[model samples]
Structures are given as structure tokens and as C-alpha cells.
Target chain A: MALATLKNVRFAGMATCVPRRILSNINDCPPSLRSERERLVRNIGIETRRICQEWQCLSDLAYDAANRLIDQLGWKKEDIDGLIVVTQSPDYLIPSTAIILQDRLGLEHTTIAYDVNLGCSGYPFGLHLLGSLIATGSVRKGLLVVGDKSATIKDPLFSDAGTVTALEFRENSNPWFFDLNSDGSGFKAIMLPVGGHRNPVKFFHLIPSEDEHGILHLPTDLILDGTAVLSFSTQRVPPAVEKTLAYANKKIDEIDYFLFHQANKMINETIRKKLRLPEERVPSTLKEFGNTSGASIPVTITARLREKLTEGSKQLLLGGFGIGLSWGTAIIKVEEACLPELIEA
Target chain B: MEEFIEKFQEAVDFQDPVEVTENTVLLDLPEWDSLAALGVIVMFDIEYGKTITGDHLLKSKTIKDLFELTVA
Candidate 1:
């Protein structure tokens, strides 16, 4: 039960940046999946996804999003005390992406900058990380840049984007409640077996091979066991959500919106039904952006509830699960968050 | 057992109306594919409150075998 409430911290604003290229699962299906295109689109709920150009990387998108958010919030880069980047995709194998982003964002050299290796569960976890730091009051403000530009595998299941969530210290603010958990035994449920030190990239890993489903994959590519992942998410997420609500001493109905990590249509829908939340209360970006991995939660908020989040005060319950076999829930208050228009790079 | 069979039919959602019995070799059906497997997995989890893995789905040959795994 990793549950805690961080005080003296509030969300200032957030911005999301996605690649300009849009690839439709229905219109641009590979020959192997062409026959099941309609069925896949219906069940998975990913109509299209944004893909980065060959020259672009995840850091590029994160940098753009951070700049947009900083500019929108009208904050000086030097005032920021910390920068935490959450991404499984890095600009390079060495020296955390946050360091690069720190220099790129023109933040002070004294700022605390680092990266967390996570996917799907990254956003809520990143919030907890930076929120706790800011709660200390020594760290006045910080940027949580989380997202991923998945491998160019030509699968609609993966989309590319980055987001920057700006959080600042404000005494007597509403406490942010969070419950985070991870199961290492199920890490294999979604993994890249190669390219890591455990299994160094080999010649064979570079060559593409067809799986039983006829979808081709390189050994270095992400291998997702849909059945295992679906079962894990459905069973794990609902409990975490309930626990977070209970931890906050808040009821499910009190939350104005439920933002779930946009894994897919089926997984999210199943979790929603288990919690008995109405479809209207749970917003989804899956239909348009597919699964942007860590970026899904913020991207969905920026894409779907931009106006409401920007103009009104609301209670939000966010659930992020999958990858690292991890899951977490957060209950927070958003009051006129300074959200800018979605950026394309 | 009959209830399980009916729900399984609904979950798999074959294009053609196909009669599924306890003895039916589920994987042998033309409509039984990865998507169908996912459907059954979700059904078992949501309806039976049992979490069955991809390995369990592959190891079970007949519909009865799957039902047993769900209840076992």
C-alpha cells in the first residue's frame, strides 16, 4: 500500500505536443492486419495515431511541450528548481534525457534533473515524484515531462507524443492523494527483451520475424501479451482506484472526471464497468490518438477536456496502469489549469 | 456448465451462429482467433472473477476445459 498525500503543491498547467504525421489504422493497415482492420479498429478503439519523422525523437516532443507550457504559464526558467522526465524512450542510451532537456529548456544548472524508466504508469508516478519534492517547499516549482515515441513498428497500438505538467508550491492547497503499485513477476507481460544489458542486442534481434498472429516483430521491439496485460489491468486498476478514493476520504461520485491511461478501448472499458462509472464520466483519447503510452493521460486531458480544465475548477481521479506491471491512482483538484492549445512538431 | 457455454458464445461472438457444447474444441473453430481468445479471457475475468492467462487459454483444448480452469 504505497499511499500518501502530498500537501502544499498544486498543478499550474500542462501542455502536450504530438507529431504532425497521422497514420490511420483503418486506412493504412499492413497486409497482415488488413483483413481484421475493421474489427481491430472497433475493439481497440484506435482510429489513428501520430508518428514522429525519422529525424525526430521523444525528447524533441517533450522539449516543445515544456516550452509551450513554460511560455503559457509565464514562468522564468531560472525559477524552476527541478525537472523530472518520465519516459521509456531516451534520446540516447547514456546520460538521462532530463539532463538534455534541462539544458534544452534553459533551466538553471543547479536544478534537480533526472529521468524515470516507466511506461503507462509514468504520469501519476511522475506527479508523485515531483509533487513530493515541491511539497518540501525547498523546491518551489518543477516540470514533469512524461511521454514516449515508441519504436517505428508500424503497429497502430503505439502512438508518439510528449507532455509537460507544471506544478508549483502553494501553502494550504488541497492535498494530492496517490496509491501506486508494481508487480515485477508480470513485467514480461509487456517488455522489450533485447537492447538491454540483460539481453544485449544481437544480429538475430535486428532481423524481423513473424509471430503466430502474423504480425512481424524484431526482437528489440516491444512485445505485448494482450491477454496477460488485459487481465492484469482489469484486476489491478479498480482496486487501486478504490483505495485512492478511500485514502482521500472521497467518494467516486465526487470526482468530476476519471482520466484513465488510454491503453485501448477494451481494457479501459472493462475497468470502467467494474468500478460502475458511467461512460460519460470517463473520458477517452483512444479513439483518436491510440495508446500514447505514458503521454496518454495528459494527452487525453489536453485533447478532450482542454476548455473545461482551463476554465473551471474540477476534481479529477487519474488511473494509470500497464508496463512494469505497474498501476497507480491520483485524486487532485484542478482550478483553471493554464492549458495551451495542443502543439504539433 | 450450460450457462458458461452460452456466455462463452456471446463473448467469442462468431460471425456465424455456431453451436458450442462442453465437448467443443474451441480452438478448432474458424472464428477462434487471437481476438476471440481475448474475448474469452475478458469474459472469464469479468463474469467468473477468475484471471486466466494466455497460457491457460492455449493449454485448454475444449470449452469444458476452459470452464474448469475458470472455476478451479
Candidate 2:
């Protein structure tokens, strides 16, 4: 029960930046599965996805997102006292990406910055991290930048984008309720097996096998056990949501929106039905972005709920599940006019 | 139980409309592959209120076998 309720911390606005390159599974589907495109679309609901160019890194997209929000909100760079970039993808192995972005975004040396290596569960967890800090009075205003260019590896299951959320400490701000859970036991369920300390990428790791459906995968490519992942999501997310709502002492109908990680239409829909939520309450970016790893939840916000977020304040219950075999739920309020339009880099 | 056949027909989507029954062997269907098998598990869970595994779907043989797994 990793639950926390924090006050005096609040979100101001968020901006998302995605690469301009769009790839389609219909076009990119491996030769073995060419005819199954329509069926795939119906099940997963991702027709097109954005891909990062070779020159663009995760930090590039995140920096663009963070800088854009800073400019839009008219915040002086020095006023921001903390930065946290959440992503499993990083530009270099040595220097932390968050540290680079602090300088790249022109924040002062006193600002706290670091990276959290998480995938789909990263966004809200990142928010929870920064919000908790802001509530503790150690930092006043902070930038939480989250993104990953996971699509660069030619794997169609992933897309890439970055999102930056601005948070500030204020007296009497709405409280943020959170329940975060992680099962390292399920880490192998969604993972990149090689190119890490456990199994560094060797020359032999590049072997490609074209499946019966024509999709080709390499040894170094991210390995996903779809069956295990699916079963985990179906079983875990409902309870996580229930306990999170219970911790927050809120009912399903009381919340204005029920947003979950845009893992796919199938999984998200299952969780939605399990909770008995109406379709209108759960928004999606899976169709446009096709599983943007850490960026999916926030990307969904900038993509779908721009008007609802901008026109009026809304009480939101957001759940993010997958990769780290992690899942978390948070109850936060979105103030009126806090979300900017989605942008392409 | 009879309507389960029609629902099974919808679940294991075949490119050709192959009539299915309790005794119809699933391996004989054209669309019966790993993807469609996953689809069957998804359908059983969502539509039939039966939580099934990929391995369970793999062990299943006939259309009726899948229906039995749902009820089991």
C-alpha cells in the first residue's frame, strides 16, 4: 500500500511534443502479417504512430516540450527549482538526461534534477515525485519532463514523444492522492533484454527472425511477453484502482475522468469495464501515438482533453500500468486553462 | 450452449465464414493462428466473462472445447 496524500502542491500546465515522422503498421507490418492489418487496427486501435528521427533523442523531445510550456506559461527559468525527466530511454549512458535538460532548459544550478528509468508507469510516478517534493517545502516551483523515443529502434509496438508538466507550491492548493505499486517479479514481462548491464548488446545479439506473420524481431529489440503482460494488466489494474480510490476516499462517479495509460484499446477498455466507467470518461492517445511508453498518459491529455482541461477545472483519476511491471493511480485536479495544445517537433 | 457456437464463430474470426458447432475442430479453420488465438482469449474474457490463458486456448481443440473452457 504505497499510498500518499499530499497538499500545498499543484499542477499548472502541461505541453507535449512528438516527432513529425509518422509510421503506419499497415505499411510497416512484417511480411508475414500483411493481410491482418485491419484486424490489428480493430483490436489495438493504433492506425498510425509518430517516430523519432535518428538525430533526435528523448531529451530533445522533452526539452522542446519543457521549453514550450515554460514560454507559454511565462515562467522565468530561475523560478523553477527542480526538474525530473522520466524515461527509460536516454541519450547517453553516463550523464543523466535530467541533468542535461536542467542546463538545456536554462534552469539555475541550484535546481534539483534526475531521471527515473520507467516506461508506461513513469508519468504519474514522476508527478507524484515532484508533487511530494513541492509539498515538503524543499522546492517551490518545479518542472517534471517525461518522454521516450522508443520508436527509433524500428519496433512498431512503440511510439515516441515527450511531455513537460509545471507544478508549483501554494497554500490551500488541492491535495493530490496517489497509490503507486511495482512488482519487480513481473519486470521480464515488458523489457528490453539486452543493451544493459545484465546483457550488454553483443554483435550476436542482432539476429533477426521473421515470424510467420512477417514481423521481424532482433535479440536486442525489446521483448514483450504479450500473454503475461495482458493477464497482469487485467488482474492488477482493477484492484490498484479500487485501493487507490479507497485511499483517496472517493467514489467512481465522483471523479470527472478516468484516464489510464494508453497501452492499447483492448487493455484500457477491459480496465474501464472492470470499473464500470462510461467510455466518455476514459480518453485515449493510442490511436494517434500507438503506445508512447512513458509519454502515453500525458500525451493523451494534450491530445484528447485540451478543451475539457482548458474550459474548466476537472477532478481526474489517472492510472498508469506496464513496464517495470508497475502500475499506479493518482487523484489530482486539473485547473482551468492549464493544458496547452499538442505540438510536433 | 447453442448460442455459444455463434459467439465462438464471432470470436475466432475467419476470413471465410466457416460454420462452427460444438464438434467443429478449431485447427481446421483458416484464421486459427497465434494472433486469432489471442483474439479468442480476449473474446472469452471480455464477451463470455471467462478469464482464459493463451496456453488454455492452445490446449483447446474443438469450438465446443473453447465453450467448455468458458463454462469451466
Candidate 3:
């Protein structure tokens, strides 16, 4: 039997959440004690960092963003029939973060709520999953929440942030097409070394220290092979974009804008150069916020919309890739569901 | 060596002088961070084929200790 065909879905609203704690350049630290790693932060183009206060969790960020989107769109909690929260950081590993969000938001128990453990490629993949569900008549209104706290990794390269995109299922409309893929073999490219099933927490505690370069060092902490990740991103990301465009029977020039995951300044710059996209078409927030994992893309979109860069645009090419060694892309036509201005936070 | 230290200090946004003495306390300097640690590690590994970890630096409180470890 042939597989069932899925219909098109539209994104109606967007919102983002960032912690109040801002680590800016103005913060004082002695120069003679500076480390090489500290220098890398300045060189990498990050200006400020955000961290959730001690009492907050990943769900809090997701809920804040979701509530803001709901408020901006004048959407009732009952209107949302489905919710998908894509995050790698959870308050507890046992119960999914979505269930907690659903209860907190006063969503109906019947609401299809679940969590997808994903990073980097999460925004596009979550969009694809929700779009498929809406198209198949599984639910009418769906909310895709993407966020993560790199604090768990103890890596300053990541910031605490979340984003919510409300998607409305529209009939007879040519919704965007998505191309998704994953290769688990390269999962080690970027990962946290502790706090998992394989490497449970033990008696020994590891803290940050300073190396010869005067940089604070945290060995036995989050270890990322920067070169490996850079090579993977530069190699896999562009092809994913090109293949998706080809599948949609569209050319690079036909794409109005490209919203990619804000992995870093270097990766984004490399991809932009490789794709030969106009500087105006690509949006990035790594310089100010660092990498917010899954929240990067929607946050970028919201930022661009606020800047008036997305006004009057129809075709937008969205791509997100990272972490799972996973990546994907999609193309959507802007409509009323696409709100230009909402929550700026 | 002094020029390298100067560039390193500038790269890490340290306000101190470029002339780093062997006994300078790295932890007392303001430019230390995870990124700076990685940069120093890469620099030492590339220039002198030395690999130092956070634990090693934690044991040594001064620049003289680091130089000794690197040269040894």
C-alpha cells in the first residue's frame, strides 16, 4: 500500500524567552590571570551571555515563551490541541517536559503533548514533525517549543533561551516541504561528558580551573571537538540545504531568506560563504546571545521580524543542523499566520 | 616570547602589561575562561608539543610552574 500523503501547515505566531542574567564584556576579571579559553570567547564573536537563575529550569523558559506567544496571538489554551517540546535538558529524565508544560499551561489532558529529545537540528525537525501531525488531521492547533540550557554542560558557549512557534493547519494550501536526515555515528562531535546513563555522577567532583593560557578550564566536563564539529557543520549543512531546495524544485535564488541555527559566528559565516547567500538574507544572533541550541532559529526569526527584515517576504528557506549529527531544511510561504512583531524578550 | 604574551593578553582582553614573568600567578589574572584555556592548550600543543590539563594547572599557582611543566 502507498503511504498516506500529508497536507500543508502554516506557522501563525512566534515568541522567545531569555534569562535576566546577562554576562556582558564589562564584567571585570584580572588580565594577568586570563586564560587562552577566555580569549576564545572574545574571538568567537560573543558579546553577552544569558543564564537562568538558580530556581529556573528548562521547562520554565519554554513555558515563558509559549505563554508569550499565546498572549500575543490572543490564543486560548483550549485552542491548542497538540504540543511538542524539543529539548535536551529536562527537569527530570523520567517524566517528559511536555507533560509538565501541559499541566502548567492548563492544557486539556486529551491534548497530544510529548517531548522530543533533540538539539541543533531540533527547530526544523520539530517543525516537520508538527506539520506532519497537523496535516494528517491528528490535531488542529500545535505548539512547537524549542529550548535548552547549556549550563548543564558548564560550557559558556551556550546560553539559556527558548522559543515557541504556533502552527495552524490550513487545508488546500501548499504548505512547505521538509527534508530530514540523521547519522548517529558522529554523535560524539559535541556532547557533555557527564550526567547521563553511561556516565552517572560519582563521588569525584570536577570544577573549573585555569590553564597555561590563563583560561579557566573544566576538564572532565563538557568536551567538544571543535574542529570535528566545524568540519561536520561545513560539510553536512550546505548539502542538506541544497538537497532540500532541489527536492522542492526550487533554486537558491528563489529562496527569499535563510534562517539557520545560530551555532556560532564561524560556522554561520562559513555556510553563508559556501551558499553565496546575500548578507541580508541570513540572520544570526550568536554574537549577542551565544548558541541557544534549538531556540536559535525561531529566536533569529523573531529578531529579524522585529528589525523589519522579514516584512513583505513570501518564501523563506529554514534550515537547522547540529548535535545529533542530525540536520534538515524546509521552505514555507509567508502568510497571515506569520506575525511580524510579538514578544521581543 | 614577550610579544607572544602580549598578543595573548590582547587576544583575551586583559588590561595588564604584556610582559609576563615566570612566577606570574595565572589564577590572579583576569582573562581566564574556558575558551582561553582551549586557546592556550592549542597554542602550547602546536608550538611546543605540550599537553596540559586543568588539573595540572590547578596544582601549579604560578607562571613559573606552568613553564616548568611545559619545558619538562
The global Cα lDDT (0 to 1) of model 1 is: 0.89
Which sequence of candidate numbers ranks them by TM-score, best first?
Answer: 1, 2, 3
Over the stretch A232-259, how does candidate 3's per-residue lDDT look in tens digits? 6766788878887877888988887899
Best candidate, DockQ-wise? 1
* lDDT for residue A230 in candidate 3, whole number 0-100: 62
lDDT of 3: 0.72
TM-score of 1: 0.94
CA lDDT, every prediction?
0.89, 0.83, 0.72
lDDT tens digits, residue span A1-345, model 2: 499988998788999999999998777666556666667677778878998888999889888888888888888998999998888888888688999888888889999988888889887799899998899987899988888888843454689898999999988988899999999998888888898899998988888887766556788877787777877888789988899888888898889988888887778887888778898888887887899887888898898888888888899998888998898889998886467678888
When summed lDDT is taken over every stretch of 10 residues in candidate 3 chain A, the lowest stretch is: A1-10
Docking class of 2: acceptable
The superposed Cα distance between candidate 3 and the true structure at residue B5, in angstroms, equals: 21
State the lDDT of candidate 2 residue by residue for B1-72, as single tens digits. Answer: 677776666665655677777887888887777656666766777777778887897788888788788778
Question: RMSD to native for every prediction?
Answer: 2.0, 2.0, 8.0
The regions of model 2 sitting more than 4 angstroms off are A27-32, A152-154, A210-216
Give the per-residue lDDT digits (tens) of candidate 3, residues B1-72. Answer: 464565445434543444566667887776565444544544444345555554565677776676666668
- Sorting all predicted structures by DockQ, with the top scorer first, yields 1, 2, 3
